[model samples]
Target: MQRYKCTISYDGTLFSGYQVQPQKRTVQSEIEEALKKLHKGSPIRITASGRTDAGVHARGQVIHFDSPLHIPEDKWVNALHSLLPDDIAVKKVEKAAPDFHARFDATGKEYRYFVRLSNYKDPFTRHYQFQYGYPLDIKQMKAAADYLVGTHDFTSFCSAKTEVEDRVRTILRVGIEMSREQLMFRFVGDGFLYNMVRILVGTLLETGRGLHQPEDMKTILAGKDRSLAGKTAAAHGLYLWEVFY
Candidate 1:
């Protein structure tokens, strides 16, 4: 058997989430179904770099699976493309080391969130961007984001539903960019806890809206209390932008 790595993109609007669930559609279920069909009755399971919640999208999600077939890498992409649903696209396929794991081997990840700046809801982007019409102070947001950089315990930013005990993670960078139509928040980190990115975005947004001072981020981080953070941002606006190996 050989291990193959595939970089994929998906429109998660219709997916229950990335993981398989009983009687519900998911990204993993769809890809595994396609692989099972390709194997002509044999089952194949894929390991993704991480999971995305419902309505969250991905532009560069990575997964790895073991297969006995000898098909060329390009053909693997074509084969999976023909079998997957229209919402999912296999962007690239390549042979990987036998011991390489999509999740455990990942070095870092980048996530991006988009927010609509205007009150006029564009039907075209409703599923892709979070609609937030309130005035936001970009400078204040940036100032608040600065405190998030570097290694720190992020219990305050994580969702209470998360079971992971290690709340410490390193954030390489945090960027806030705005255009006439929308604002984009970018986060590059070693790893993230459940809902960490969404919570971070929500907190920064609150700072931008004058609900909190820019320096309040430091206090929140020190508090390590989830309730001290802002509301969790909508999942639809978030994207798993990339996984760094």
Candidate 2:
């Protein structure tokens, strides 16, 4: 069997998420179905680097699966792209070592949350960005973000429903970049719990709005209480920037 590593980009606006769920449309299910069609009668299973929530987007998601077919690695990209939906595109495919597990081998991931701070929302960007009419203190947000960098038990930032026993994760970086109307919060971490990024963004936004102090982030991290953090931001504003091995 040959293991194929596939890099894909998807607009997650319509799908339930990345994982395959019974009776639900998902990126994994769609890709597996297309693979099954390509393989004729054989069953196919794809393993993704991580599961993205509904309405989120991905620019460099990675997955791997084993196939019995003898198709050339160079042809896999074009073949898969032709069969997949327009919203999902196969960026590249190559033969991977058998031991390369997409999830287990992943080293880090980068995510970005976009917010549009303006009086009126742009119709074109409505679906992709979160719109906030009030002005934000970008400097204050950055100050709070600095506290989030490095290793910490991010229990406060993660969703209460997360089943993971360990809440500790290393955040390599937290950066804020602003354009004329867009505010982007970029996070690079070893891994993230469910809704962790969104919650972090929300907390930062609260600080920006003067609802919370910049030093409050230190308290929140130490408290490890979900109630202390701000609300989880909308999923549409989040994007899986990339997955690194």
Candidate 3:
């Protein structure tokens, strides 16, 4: 059997999420169905670098699967594109080393959350961004973001339903950027627990609004209590920007 790596991009507005769930439309299920049609009765299991939640999008998600078919690397991209839906596309496909595991081999991931701070929301961009009418103090948001850039027990930032044993992870970087009426929070991390990024964004939003102090993050981290953190932001504004190997 030969292993193949596929880079995928999808607009996640309509699907349940990345994982395969019975009776639910999902990105992984859609891709697997297309692969089954191509392979003709053979079952294909695809593993992604990370599983994104419902309503969250991806610009560069990567996955790998083994297949016995002999399709050329270049043809795989077009073939899959023709078979898949318009919202989901195969960016590239190549023969992967036999031992390369998509999830296990990933070194880090980068995510971006978009917020629209304008008086009027754009209908076209509403699906991809969070809209808030208040003017955010960008400098204070940056100061709060600075406190999150290191290894720490992120219990306060994670969802209550997260099943992970360890709550500690390394955040490589966090930045706030503004362009026109849009503001974005970008984060790079070794890995994230469920709703961690969203909660962090929510807490920073509170800080930007002058409701929370920039130093509050330090206390939240030390508390390790979920109740001390902000509400989880909407999933639609979050994107899995890229996965690094």
Candidate 4:
């Protein structure tokens, strides 16, 4: 058997989530179904870099699977494209080392969130971007984000439901950029806990509205309390941008 890595993109509007669940339509179920069809009754399991919540999209999601077929790299992409649903597209496929794992081998990830800053909502983008008409102080948000970059315990920014005991993670960078009426928040980190990115975004938005001082982020981090953070941002506005191995 040979291991193959694939890069894919998906629109997450109609699915339950990334992981498979009983009697529920999910991204993993859809892709595994396509693989089952390709193998003509044989089961093939794939491993993804990570899971995304319902309504959270992906532009550069990566996965790896073992296959016995001798198909070329380009043909693998074409074959999967023909089998997958319209919402999911396979962008590229390549042979990977036999022991390489999509999740365990990943070194870092980048996530992006989009917010619409206009009063008039565009029907096409309503499902993709969060609409926030209130004015945001960009400078304040940037200042607050600066406090989050670096290695630290992120218990305050994660969901209470997270089961992992190690809440420490390293954030490489945080970027806030505006283009026209659209605002983009970019985060690159070694890893993230459950709902960490959404919670961080929510807190930054609150800071922009003067709900908290820019330096309050430091206090929230040092306190290590989830309740101290702002509400979780909507999942539809977030995208898994890329995974680095």
For all predicted structures, in order, the TM-scores are 0.99, 0.98, 0.98, 0.99
- The number of the candidate with the highest lDDT is 1
Q: Write the per-residue lDDT of candidate 4 for residues 1-245, one digit (tens) a residue.
A: 99999999999888898999999889999999999999997999989999999999999999999999999999998899889999999999999999999999999999999999889869999879988887999999999999999999999999999999999999999999999999999999999999999999999999999998889999999999999999999999999999999
Alpha carbon deviation, residue 168, candidate 4 (Å):
0.4
Q: Could you tell me which residue pairs clash in candidate 3?
A: none
Indicate the residue-level lDDT of 145 in model 2: 88
Question: Could you give the C-alpha RMSD of every candidate to the true structure, in order shown?
Answer: 0.6, 0.9, 0.9, 0.7
Q: Residue 165 in candidate 3 has what lDDT? A: 81
lDDT of 3 at 107: 93
Better of 1 and 4 by lDDT: 1
Q: How accurate locally, in lDDT, is each candidate?
A: 0.96, 0.92, 0.92, 0.95
> Which residue pairs show backbone clashes in model 4?
none
User: Model 2, residue 29: what's the lDDT?
Assistant: 92
